[model samples]
Target: MSSLKLKRFIKDSFPDNNLIIVSNREPYLHNKSGSNIKVEMPAGGLTSAMDEALRSTGGTWVAWGSGSEDKNNVDDNDRVAVPPGKPSYTLKR
Candidate 1:
C-alpha cells in the first residue's frame, strides 16, 4: 500500500538516507480482551527485507486505547509518538 509506493519511489529516486517505517500497530497479537490488547510483532519477511535494505533502520510502534490518553514509558531518540493533538507525524531524512 502506502509503504510499497513509498519504497518504490525512494528506491528509484533517492537511495541514500536510510529508511525507517513506524506504524501504529505491529503485525501480530499477543492478547486481546475486554477492549485491552497486547502485541508481539515479529521480524517478518517484509520487515526484515526492509530493514536489510536500509543502511540504518529502526521503527517505533505504539499501543493505545480508543478513549484513553497515552501513558508512554519508552523514550527513544529516534522513536516518536502520535499523541492526541497530532494523530500522525511523518519525517524524512
Candidate 2:
C-alpha cells in the first residue's frame, strides 16, 4: 500500500490522537564534522515509512540515541524538535 493510504488508515483508525513511534534506532542521525553537524536519514526502515505521516501530523518519535553527537542535540530532557526547519515531531532520546 501507498504511504498516503497508510496515513489515511492510521488517521481513520485513531482520530484525535497523537502518533508515537518507539524504536531502538533513531530515524535521523547527527554527526559533527569540522564545526558543523550533518544530519543523515537512515536508508530504509520503519522510520522511513512513518516519517511522512509524522511530519504531516506532528508527533513524537522515541528512540535510543546512540550517536556520538546525540547528547549535544537534545534538550535537558533529551528531547529534540526534529527536521531542523519547521519541526513537526519531538525526537525523545
- Top candidate on TM-score is 2
Which residue ranges in model 2 land beyond 4 Å of their true spot?
A: 1-4
Per-residue alpha-carbon lDDT of candidate 1 for residues 1-93, written as tens digits (9 for 90 to 100): 355665576666656653455544332333454666443334678644443333222232333322221123223442333322332332211
lDDT of 1 at 74: 23
**Which residue runs of candidate 1 sit more than 4 Å off their true CA positions?**
1-12, 15-41, 56-73, 76-93
**Clashes (N, CA, C under 3 Å) per candidate:** 0, 0
Cand. 2 TM to true fold: 0.84
Alpha carbon deviation, residue 3, candidate 2 (Å): 5.2
RMSD of each: 10.3, 1.8
> Which residue pairs in model 1 clash with each other?
none
